[model samples]
Target: MARSRSRSFITTEKPTTYDEDQFALPNLNSNWVYYKGAWLVHIILIICVKILLSSVPGVSSETSWTLTNLSYMLGSFVMFHWVKGVPFDFNSGAYDGLTLWEQIDNGAQFTPAKKYLTALPIGLFLLSTHYTHYDAITFLVNFTFLAVVIIAKLPQLHKVRLFGINRLEVE
Candidate 1:
């Protein structure tokens, strides 16, 4: 028997999935995230941001870490979730509607890459919290960003847009 695909009540529209598109050719846009170096890039970017923020006058360690955490979190969310469509035009717009996260691994959940991607934000949040000395305000702010990043990766929220944000126009 075939399993039925379910949608959450909050899900306003179903997302178009391209499982077969992977067999035709590889998606350079999403596949790059799997590279060993790509993972390192995230860490390097985090460290760079931490340093940049730290160098600014009057920016304490706590503030620097919090800024780094927020910067990475927002960038991750926008890159993997907020933005739709592929950067390359090779696929003839086949992936025009899917975000990088959805395009990765052909929308499979809990893959090794996905797990690592999910964990990166959590780890960063922890690092920020520790560096911030567990300040209540910093913790809450970092936690909120982390929460959004984690929620965006959830299979349930795949291709979902709340309040019509980021929904592709169907003209």
Candidate 2:
């Protein structure tokens, strides 16, 4: 009688920590540094838009408004995605020092509240843009909305939980 052989599958390697802070600002390879660089790029784009709007004379109001709103929307989208991979502790300094898995877990914990907070500003911005035809007002509203999104994601502020039964560390 031939006996069936049972194959054993076992691994003994410990999971690696996802600490990116080593590559951060001081190191220039961290996700936080990358986020800041991306933010600066967005700022430069906004400045270019402002300059173009002022220097060029025959650009239609519709065209200018479209460009401005597009910039804001693009910036917000970039921020939203960039934040997903960043390991930031709102309670700590600019650098969270937490592993990627820890940061992701923390973010997930507050994602529900964050989603609601994020949507409110976006909805208000859309409504304001739809009703306002003044170039200046539109610019102000668009800029303000973009700023709000950026501010809300800052490590110092991102951990805030709104209308939640469980309080975040920062709360």
Best by lDDT: 1
Q: Against the hidden true structure, what lDDT does model 2 obtain?
A: 0.45
> Which parts of model 1 are misplaced by more than 4 Å?
1-9, 12-22
lDDT tens per residue, model 1, 52-169: 8999999888888888888898998889998888876867677776789988987889998999999989988877766568578777888888998999899898777776666666
> Where does candidate 2 clash, by residue pair?
23-30
Query: lDDT for every model?
Result: 0.79, 0.45
RMSD of each: 4.9, 13.9
